[model samples]
Target: MGSFQIEGGHRLSGSIQPQGAKNEALQILCAVLLTSEKITINNIPDILDVNKLIRLLTNLGVKVEKTGKGSYTFKSDDLDLDYLHSEQFKIDGSGLRGSIMIVGPLLARFGKGYIPRPGGDKIGRRRLDTHFEGFIKLGAKFRYNKEDRFYGVEAPKDGLKGSYMLLEEASVTGTANIIMAAVLAKGTTTIYNAACEPYLQQLCQMLNSMGAKIGGVGSNLLTIEGVEELKGCEHRILPDMVEIGSWIGLAAMTRSEVTIKNVNWNMLGVIPNTFRKLGITIEQQGDDIHIPAHTNGYEVQSFIDGSIMNISDAPWPGFTPDLLSIMLVVATQARGSVLIHQKMFESRLFFVDKLIDMGAKIILCDPHRATVIGHDFKSTLKATTMSSPDIRAGISLLIAALSAKGTSVIHNIEQIDRGYENIDERLKAIGAKIERIA
Candidate 1:
C-alpha cells in the first residue's frame, strides 16, 4: 500500500484550484451512453474512480478520445452489448461504485443492463434497492443472480414506460440513475424525494441540454418527459465543493492563508456558512474563497440558546454528509466541543479512534455519533501512524497530520486517490510538507 509521509505543524499558503466535481463527472459520463453522437466533456478530474469508469466505457466499445487535459470526447454509436455479461466485465464493473450508473442508460436505450455488485469505500450499507426499485416503477423487470451476486434490469420489447416513484431515500447516485433511465421512457416520469444536490441538478440540466425534458432542476421533485433519443452536447463540470471544503478545513487546521480559486460560490449551498459555524473565516472574493490564517486560533459557535453546537447532515440545502469527517477533524482544534452526527453512514464515525490516538479529544458515542472536545490549540496533537479507512476519512487524517507535531505516516492512500486528484502535489504547491511514498 502507498503511504503519505508528512512533516506536521507547518502553515500552508498560496492558491489552489479545486478539480471538477467527481460525483457529477460520474453521472455525466454515464449519460454519454444515452446518445449515439459525439459528447465532449471538460473539467473531468484526473482521479482513479473517474478513470476506471472511462476505461469501463471503452471496454464496452464506446469510442473515447482525449482532447486535452481533463477533456474527453465519447461516442457510443456502437457498443458491444455482450461484454456486459462477460467475466471481464464483472471484474471491471465491480471495481468502482460508479459502475452501477451505466446500467440505467444501457437499460433505457438498449432494453437490458447488467452489472456485478459494485465495490467502493466500505463506509456503510449503500443499498441498490433505490435504483432498481425506481427502474421497476418505470416498468423494467429486475432480477438478481444469487450465485454471482449480479443485478440485471431489462425493459420490455416495447421499451420502458414512464411512471411516478417516491424514493425511500434521497440518494444522489440512485436519483441520477433513475433520471437517466426515465429520460428515455415512453411518457412523463415523476420522482418525489429525489436528491437535489448541485451535482444531481447538473445531471438534470445536462440531460435537458441533450433533448431530455426535465423540470424542477434544483428541487426535490423532478419531472422528465421521455424522448425518442438524445443528441450529444458539450458540458463543463463545476469545481468540486467537497475538495473546496477540505481545503478550507486544511487551512484552518494548519493556520494557513489559502485561497480556493473559481469555486462557483452560488452553487456551494450551505458549505461556506457551515464552516463559518465552526468559527472559521471564509471570505468570498469574486468566485474564490479566501481563508485567512487563523493565527489566534478559531472558536466554535454555540447555538442561539447557548447549547453546545450540534452538526448533522441532511438532504440538499443542508450540510453534506461527505464533509462531516472534515468538520469532525476541524472541531478538534476549536475552542468548544461539537456533536457530529453521521446519520447516513454507520461506520464513518469509527475513524475517530485514529484521531483520538493522535492526541485529539473525541468520544465515539456510537456508530452514528461522536462528541469532539476541542483542544483550543493549547495542546497540539502528537504525530502518529494511522491507516485511512475511507476517502473522506483519509483526507481528514491528512489534515490532522499536517496540524500535529512531528512526522506522521498515513497508509492506504489509494482511498484518497479515488476521490482527490494529485492531493500530495497540490499540497506541496501550497508549501505543505508532504511526500508520497510508494
Candidate 2:
C-alpha cells in the first residue's frame, strides 16, 4: 500500500493535457483480438487497468509491439486458445473489469470465451447478465461453473448467428461486447437501448475502420450487419471526460487557473454546464476548457423557481455519475447548498463521511444521495488522514486534500492510479504540493 502526502491551500496555475480516454482504451485494446492482422492503437493511457489488459493480451500469446510513447501494435495471429482455460489466465484475467471485454472478440473469432469472475472497484452491483444474455441471444450456449466461479460461452458447430437483442438497460460494456460478437456472426443484428457514450461511439468508429458495418453510431439504437471477418486498423483514443471533470473541480476548489487542453469539446456534452451550475466559471477555448480561479470565490446556482440545486447522473447527455463525487467536493466550498444524487451507483456517496470529518458540512441522506452545504470559503477545511475507496472517490478526496488547510495523507492510492495516469506528477507540474510515498 502507498499513500500521497499533500500540503494543501496551494494555488495552481498552468495548462495540463488530459490523458487519453481510459474507458475507450479498454474497449479498443480488447478489440485488437478481432483480427489476426496488425492493429495499431495510439494515445493509450498509461494507467494500471490498461497495462493489466495489455499484459493479459501478451499472456494470451498475442504479439504486442511498442511503437512509441502511448502507442502499440497488436497482432493476434498466434493466440493461444489453450491458455484461456488455465488457472493463471483466470487469476490474471479477473484483475480488472475491462478484462471481461476480451470475451466478446475471443468468442467472435474463436467461438469460445472463458473468464473468471472479474474484479474491479467496489462501487455498486455491476452485473454481467447483460453481456452473457446478449451472447446467448446470438445463438451461443452459456455455462457457469458454480464451484469454479467461471463463465464460459461457446458457439455451435456452425458458429454464432446474428439475432436481434433489446438490452434491458443501456450498459456500455455489454453493448460493445455484443457488437464485437455480432460483427462476425452470420446475419444482421439490431440492438436497442445500446449505450451511446463517446466510448461506445469510438469503438463503433474503430470497428467500421476495421471493416465492420454498424449504423446509428451515436445513439441508443444500433444496427450491425455481420461480416465474415474483420481486418486490422489504426485507432486513437479521445481525452478522458471523467478526468477532465475532475480537473475542473480541482481548479475550482483550489482557486487555481487551469486550462484542460484538447478536451474534444464536442463530446463533453453537459459536463461543463453541470459544473457551471455550481457557479464555477468555465470558458471554452476552441477544443480546450479554461477554468479560471474564482477570485471572488464561487456560489451555487438555483433553478428558475429557486429550489435547492440538484445534480444527478443519467445516461449520456446527462451528468455522469463518475463526476458527481467531484461535484460534491466542489460544492463543499461553494457559496450555497446542493443535492448530489448518485442514482447509478449506491455506495459512491459513502465517501462524504471522510469529507465531513475534515470539517465540511455534508448530510448523507441515504446510500444514494448526499446534500452538501457549502462552506463558502468562510471556513477552511482541516486536513486529516483518509483512505480512498475507489477511483473517482480517490481523486475527489485528493482534490479536497489539495484545497484543505494543513497536511493530509491519503492511503490506498493504487485506486487513483488505476484511472488517472501519472496524476501526482501531473498535479505537481501545475504547482500542487503532493508526494507519493511507498
Q: Write the per-residue lDDT of candidate 2 for residues 283-390, one digit (tens) a residue.
A: 989999999889788999999998999999998878888899999999999999999999998789889889999999999999998899999998988899999999
lDDT score at residue 85, model 1, on the 0-100 scale: 83
> Alpha carbon lDDT of residue 36, candidate 2?
95
Which regions of candidate 1 fall more than 4 Å away from where they truly are?
none
Give the TM-scores of the predictions, in the order they appear. Answer: 0.99, 0.99
Give the C-alpha miss distance for residue 280 in model 1, angstroms: 0.4
Poorest 10 consecutive residues of model 2 by lDDT? Answer: 315-324
- lDDT of candidates 1 onward, in order: 0.95, 0.94
**What is the C-alpha lDDT profile of model 1 across 284-354, one tens digit per residue?**
99999999999999899999999989999988888999999999999999999999999888788888889
Q: Give Cα distance to truth, residue 132, candidate 1, Å.
A: 0.5
Task: Tell me, by lDDT, which candidate is best.
Answer: 1
